[model samples]
Structures are given as C-alpha cells and as structure tokens.
Target: MPIKSLLILISLLLFTQNIAAKEYKWSNKLTFLGFLKKHGIPQKTYYKMHKEDKELIQEIRAGQSYSINRKKGKITTINIPVSDELMLQLKNSKKGYTYKYVEIPYDLIERTISIKMKYGFKKDLYRATKTWYYGKELEEVYSKSIPFNKMRKGDRIILFYTQRYRNNKPYTSPQIDACLIEIKGKPFYGFLMDNEKYYDSLGRQYKRTYTTRFIRPVPNMKRISSRFTHRRYHPIHKRYRPHLGIDYAARSGSRIVASSKGKVVFKGWKGGYGRTIEIQHANGLKTLYAHMRGYAKGVNRGTYVGQGKTIGYVGTSGRSTGPHLHFGLYKKGRAINPARYVSKPSAKTIKLKGKAYNKLRKLVRHYRPQFRETRARKNSIIKKESKKCLNCFKKLPPRKK
Candidate 1:
C-alpha cells in the first residue's frame, strides 16, 4: 500500500508540471541561436529573423529570467524579454515554430523604502531588501552636491520609487521619484521631474556641467503618430503599455537623416521595426531609425556619418500599420525621451526655470508633505535592521491654476 501511494504522488506531480509554465534563467554563454537549437527550435527560425530583429536578441542579458509552458516535455510556448518594453515570444504549433515581438506584460508597483545607515547605504540597503540597485542612482543624484565621505551613523535615508514586476517579483530596478538623505541633522531632498532629471528643492541641477542637445532625425515633422510614455491605456489591447520610442508619421520615400554625428553600428531589418539603422554617438548615446524604405549609399555598419546627413528613406516596414518612422534614443542601454534632448544644447549647467521649473515645483510640493511626516519620527523608532518603508506616495488633488 505504501509503495502504491508513493507512485501515485509522483504521477500527480508530473501531471501538474505539464500544465504550469516553468521559469528558467537565460545563460550568459548561450547565444540566441544556441538557445533555439538547444530547445529543438529549428535553426531557420533564427536565420529568418530580420537583421534588425536579430540584433535585438543581443539585448537578452545573462541571468535574465524567462518562462516556458510545455506538454509532455515539448515546448508549447515561450516568453523571453528582449527589451524593457518588448518581449520575444515563441509558439509551437503542429506546423512549426513561430515567433514574434510582443509587449512584455508586467505590473507597476509603487513603494517607499526607508533605512538608517548602519553599514553604509549600499550595504545596509542590501541587508534590508536583499537588493542593491538604488545605490548608484542615489550617488548619481547627490554625489556632486553632497559629500558622501561625511555620512555618519544613523544617517536616515528614504526613497519613494516605482518598479516593474513580473510573476509577482521585481522585473527591473526601482525608478526613484523622490529621495531624502539626512546629513548631520539637516535634510537634503531630490525630486524627479518629467524630463527624467532630478532637481533639488530649488530646482537646481548639479550633476553634469554641460549638456549635448540632439536633433530630430526626420525633417519636416508633419505630426507625431505616437508619443513616448511610461504608462498608458492601449486603445486596441485595453492594457496599460509603455512606448519607449516616438513615431513620426511621414510620406513614403521621404528622406531620413542622421540625428547627430555617430558611427553606424547596425543597418538591417529588425523584427517589428522593419528596415532599421542604429548609430553610436559620443557621450554614450545611441540613436535608432526604423520602418524605412532604404538606406543611403555607403552608410554601412562602422561608417561615420555627420548630423543632418541623409542615411535612409522612410516607408512602411516591419509590423507597422502605416507609413511612419519609429525613432528611438538610448543612453547606456536605457531608453529616454528624445523629445527632451532636441534643440537644447548648452555649455553651462541647465537649470529648471519658466514653465519647466513650475512643473517641477508641483512635483516637489507633492512629495514635501511626506518628508514632513518622516522628519517627526525619532531615529530610535526607525527599523534599522528590518527592510520596511515609512509610507507609500500619495497624490493630492490638483489645485486650479
């Protein structure tokens, strides 16, 4: 009787496994082609990808997690995130293996993490949360203005951030909205603005001394078909989605020029992007032009091109619904709004003023009340060893202008 029961338990476990999606970590040494081959996916499935789509597979980093659902040990579906907003999905049917780029479905979770310095900011943060992602970001925001060497014991630290979650776990690093650091007894505050820059209580920026302004790739902007956003309700899918790049609606065969001086890194068909070109410019900047008709002569990979030089022609390509160009700008592998970088090159530090500064003031006001509440708490009452936060961010109703 005991032996029969054990066999039944093993069978039940196997049956449950077949219906559930199993998660796996991507190996560093495994190329995208190698991954397909190892899983019995046909080599042609990889070779047939648009050269641009082929380049996108490189964005899959080692240790990145993916999911697979199988039946009888045969893959039925697979989802692998290739970029922050896009995923590579593979489905197996009776005919063959098929793949496409889809939006990576995730939830946005807003949180606040508070800690007191015991073993330094990074170490103490890791101790409380089991992660150390916000250290570099905090340093980048305050390193120039604050003296890190002066941090003393019990220096309070608080951050209000939002992160993307998949499978109920963190999918990416926290995007800090506001941060407060106490040096000695005085408090320093940093608030995030829509421009993706952090400013102090007075709307001053202290990180970089100079800013490199960028130009629009397409000449004569008729209109923007789609704008960049971190979150929005999709009209077709009825889901909250993020668009990392902007789309410019233009006529077919219109001239597309290089946004700035840079060397051509890639020029080929990308999955949904259709015909695409990527250029590597100075200051760790990279620009992308997609959904084009054709490339300019001699603008191959590794060729240096200057700003305003013709690089490609616009057309409907990839998974486009119409004749529009998808333009993307990235800094160190992170997508940022190209709209902010245009026509604002300056040699001196850029400070928030006028309407931009007023917008930042609103953001600061939203976060100030929380700071006041936190200031009342005694350091002895704070959970120095535990990974807990003070309170989540709250938005007050906007006042009439």
Candidate 2:
C-alpha cells in the first residue's frame, strides 16, 4: 500500500476511537430523572428502563460519569455504572432505547491478620487489618460469648477474613470467615456457619435458643443510660421514683430488635413510653421496648416476630428528654431488670455431636496454629514494653501521690 493511503487509514481509526470515547458527567444538583432530560433521553425510554430495572433508578447518584457513543451527531449508546460490579447500558435501536443490566466480575481475596492490643480492641484491630469495619465485624461475631470492652491489655486477636476486590481495589467490606480472641490466656473461637450467623468449634450456634426466654433486645448498643432500680432521680419528673426499665442510649432511628421469638401483644402509643412495643414469648416471659420513633413496618399487634427482627426505631417519643430505648423484661406479670437477662449466658446451648462437631473442629484447626504463634509474639512484645516503661518511670523524679 502507498504511504498516503496508510496515513489516511490511521486518521480514520483515530477519529472512530474519539467518537466512541465521548463521556458525559451528571451534575450534582440534578436528580437522575432530570439528568436524563438534560441529556435528551426521552421520557418513554426512561420509563421503559425503570419498568425493566427498578434498581437503575434507585442506585443512581449525582457526579457519576457515563459513556455516550454518537453516530452522525445522534447518541447511539449510553453506559452508566450503577455500582462497582454492575453497569446499566442503554442502546438506541429502531424501536427506541433498550436497557440492559451488566455485571462486572470481582475476585474474592482471603486475608489473615494478627495483632496484640496496645490500645483498645477496635483500634488495634483496625491497625492490623487496615480496614475500619473489621472491628465491628469481630465484635458482632464474639458479642454472645466475649466482652470486647473488658478485653485486657495483653489480649491478642487473630482474624481470617475475605473481601471482594475489583482491579485489586477493595469493593466490599471485609467479612470474618473465622476469628480467635485470646483474653487473659483463654481462647474463644468463632467460625462463620452461614450468612448472618456464627458458630463455635463444637458447631453450637452463637445465638441463644428460643427456649432461653430472653436475649439482648439491643445487642448493638453498648451504653445503658439508666438501670432498673427501686429509687432514682427522674430526669424529667424532677423527683425520686422507681425506674422500671433500663434505658439504652442509641441514635434515633437505630433498630430496636425483639429479644425473643414471640407474638406482638401490643404495638402502639403508650402514655410516657412514647411508641411502645411489647412481645409475649414462651413461658410467660414478656419484653417491652419503649421510646421508639415509630414501629417497624408490618410489625403490629398479633403479629409474630422472630428473635432478631426489628420491632421499632429508637426515639424520644413521649415524656423523654433525648433519644434512647427503654427496655423492660417481665416474668409472668412482674417487672424485672432487663440487664439480668442479657448479662447471664443462655442456659440452653445447641450441642453438636458426631459428624457435625467434627467438621467444625477441622475448620477451627486450620487457624489454631496461626493464632497460637500470634499470641506468643504478642506476649513477648508486651513483656518488653512493660519492662521498658518500668525503667523509664524509675529514672524520672519521684512525685507525691
């Protein structure tokens, strides 16, 4: 071929590439619906896309970029990224624009991290894992058996986790596959049995049985603003009175869960309790949640709710100073301390035997050696640090205590 002909062919290829690479950005002030209008997308086509894929409308956000391919000054194709793993593509055809959802593949990467606590468990866990969310995951896994707040100075933790990655960048939060926490030389192991549940080495579920009568109504809340007592100063009443229930300080709209599986005997407004929900469980055990902003949708009187279902949202509905959940526990018809029920371990535990227990044991053994080594190293470091601190203190001028 002649040199002139080759140059003309290269110019044509470059021009085609530029046309295909035309990209547009959605403005921050415009909603997704308005964005389509600004871009000349027809209302009928937008409605058709929404009818076919509701998520396309639900997941759109401002400032997102989309590619637009034009043919003779008419847009032919639009590709919008819905999420890291999903894309919404619309193409112009004789019939109009047609939409299709495209899924992007990602790699699931397994990771292991071991760390000794110099600070709190959350801080140390975050430092070792380099992920902020792993601390919460660890706490949730061990909340049933371990007290994370009570973990001592020399406690060590080993976590085997998995995360999804796209192009070697994290695309999802880390999930705990298995974890071992050693508090004061005692090891507690938690293995992921399934989605939303964990088990011990013996294949016992971390959650209590329904027959246990009571579980934590709000396991995620760490602080109790008020405790059940015969006499206490009322925050609003300005007088001494009996506080019938415990007040769990939580953010407004935070989920208030049912303590046990039972029927919703009452779910409506109460005088000072604001929005109240009461569940009647087996064996005459009853639990109450008060000071809720509103009841969870579909949760009403006569409805049976599961142990961990969201019953209401935290709020200062009536006669309350701030947002908090007033939790009450009852036996037969008498009010009791809700803390007692949660502080005590469940009397009944699901014991796995034979093949089931062995399977869990094998899975735990895979991480045991790693945990042991990590714990040993942590102890050595703590010992050295302690000695160094003692020497430094001795060298300083003594002050009156």
Candidates' lDDT values, in order?
0.74, 0.67
Runs of candidate 1 with Cα error greater than 4 angstroms are: 1-12, 20-65, 82-158, 163-170, 180-210, 230-232, 236-242, 251-254, 282-284, 319-323, 332-334, 343-369, 376-401
lDDT of 2 by residue, 55-151 (tens): 2243343566678888767788887765444567778888877876554456666666767767887888666556667786776676545666677
Tell me the deviation in Å of residue 363 in model 2.
Answer: 5.0
Report the C-alpha lDDT of model 1 over 1-401, residue by residue, as the tens digit.
69999999999998987777888999867877788888888999887775445645655757878999999778899998866766788899998888776677666666667777887877877776776667767875663457655777888888877776777877666678788887775678888776267788888765543344467878966789988764444555443345667889888888899999999998997656778999999978899898889999989999999999999998887754777788888877677778756534344656898997887787778778866676567652332222332222223223223
| Best candidate, lDDT | 1
How far out, in Å, is residue 291 in model 1? 2.0
Residue clash pairs of candidate 1: 52-269, 52-270, 53-270, 53-271
Against the hidden reference, what TM-scores do the models get? Answer: 0.60, 0.48
Q: What lDDT does candidate 1 reach at residue 141?
A: 65
The TM-score of candidate 1 is: 0.60
